[model samples]
Target: MIILMGIRDDEQVQRLISLDSKSSLADVVTICRSYEAAKCATSAIRAPPDQLRAVSAYKKGKKNKGHEKNLSTKPSPTTATFCKCCAKQHEPIACPATQSICTSCGRQGHWARTVQCPANQAQCLFCGHVGHYDKCCKTKKKDGRQSGSSGNSSAPNNNKHQDTRINSCRHLGSAAPTATKTPQPLNVLVSYGEATFHLLMLPDTGADVTVIGKRHLEILGIPQSSLQPPACTTTLTADGSTMAPALGIFKATLNLGKRSCPARILVHEGVQTPLLSYGHYKAIWL
Candidate 1:
């Protein structure tokens, strides 16, 4: 693991050792810090202007900060207008839903705007594009004449099975998706007390709350006793996991280049990195 642009460091070496458990630290360091690997990493991170668009979020453009915020603002559907999308008696823009809700599949985050709504259908990632998915997906007989296989492969027939993964799929024909992942240590600094730590933060568009990792709190030497009482909140993690017994929540001033704001963050154990969710994004705009 190159720390930066394929540059090898002690931190990356230790990380490798932890992963393999059996590998010698010196050997792991040698492979990751090879000159060829360093060259490749340097080029990848130093890509030309056009390629940088893929990493647009990291760019600090010359536009006035206020102007930049306006450019990125997604003017929500009118708040006063009832949401025809969800058939909910609420304005679309003000909808606080962090997950996609649709009657068709009864799943999260999948919108109704797809070319075809996949509800109560089986789609084989293997072959039969989509029909109604279960333990086994066989093509239904569209034509009466069949050579080898045909069956009534539609409808929810597995109701007898208490827990099937089908309902977990966010859409019909699609498998349950893992959480969105982000690269760590974002090289972004979080200033607290008088020291600044290069903290890792994932930007989650779907999350309404911002969270700080327990490891970060420990490293910063903040005693859990000092934190407020629990808010009876539980957080869903990206890796299909949950962070429970919310340690506490508090307001802290966060600083980025030329921008600073107070952020309310939920504290939870077992987090690998801090999450910069909607609240954090909104704070930067302020």
Candidate 2:
């Protein structure tokens, strides 16, 4: 009973209990010795080929003192390792694998892990994926726009409202004539700490910074007092005309698909349409 209680394997315990009932202690000792011998034989047959080679080399090196140092310095052929410059192990001077090249900018001299990639900086604020922005995400595609419509405006049927509205800043570059057709608006989900709301914004590739209407503070459940002073007093309108000076600057986070990114929004009372600038757009979708 004492021996059976100590035995962990069910088969071994049951066999020993049955044998004890039929035989004596001498028979149990013989059976244990046979099981240990069979286990040793099985292990010897299943030994790794690299381990066998290493053992043979170690034995040969022991016969000669000079070969001992050479064998110790050289790594085994089948051993797995992580290289500093590449994915696979190679000579110190040159890497045999192409993983040394940067996957982001296509540059050499460092791996993507060592050096920061442009794609990493441009990761989607939504969805948290690389190589694409939140605007390009398929899962959050319908969240922004519906089919066959330019955009859903916050204020409907307001003819005075322009699709691309700006503030008092000067328009960048010379006023070149553009098409009369209005550009499509991008619906962005913005969050300010605990407050989350959707804003209809124009994807203005020509604009320098993102700007939003001051009225959005009401929807965000944040007072205008929480806003900071604007970095620049003046802002530009879509038609190159100047309106009112910026009210203030509000730092908030924008969530699209699955990712969220911090954004600096220039809040203005005169802004009817939120403008998503070129720099933020490049970092997101470009």
Following a full C-alpha superposition, what root-mean-square deviation does model 2 have from the true structure?
19.8
lDDT of 1 by residue, 143-261 (tens): 22232222333234434221343333324223222321232233345665566666657655346687786787887667777777766656665444676777887666666667766
Model 2 bad stretches (over 4 Å): 1-183, 238-240
Instruction: Please give the CA lDDT of all the candidate structures.
Output: 0.54, 0.61
Q: Global lDDT for candidate 1? A: 0.54
**Best candidate, TM-score:** 2
Which segments of model 1 are wrong by more than 4 Å?
A: 1-169, 172-198, 239-241
* Least well predicted 10-residue stretch by lDDT in candidate 1: 140-149
Residue lDDT tens for model 2, 186-249 = 6678888777888877766557779877766676677888888876545656465775777788
TM-score of each: 0.34, 0.37
Q: lDDT, candidate 2, residue 189?
A: 85
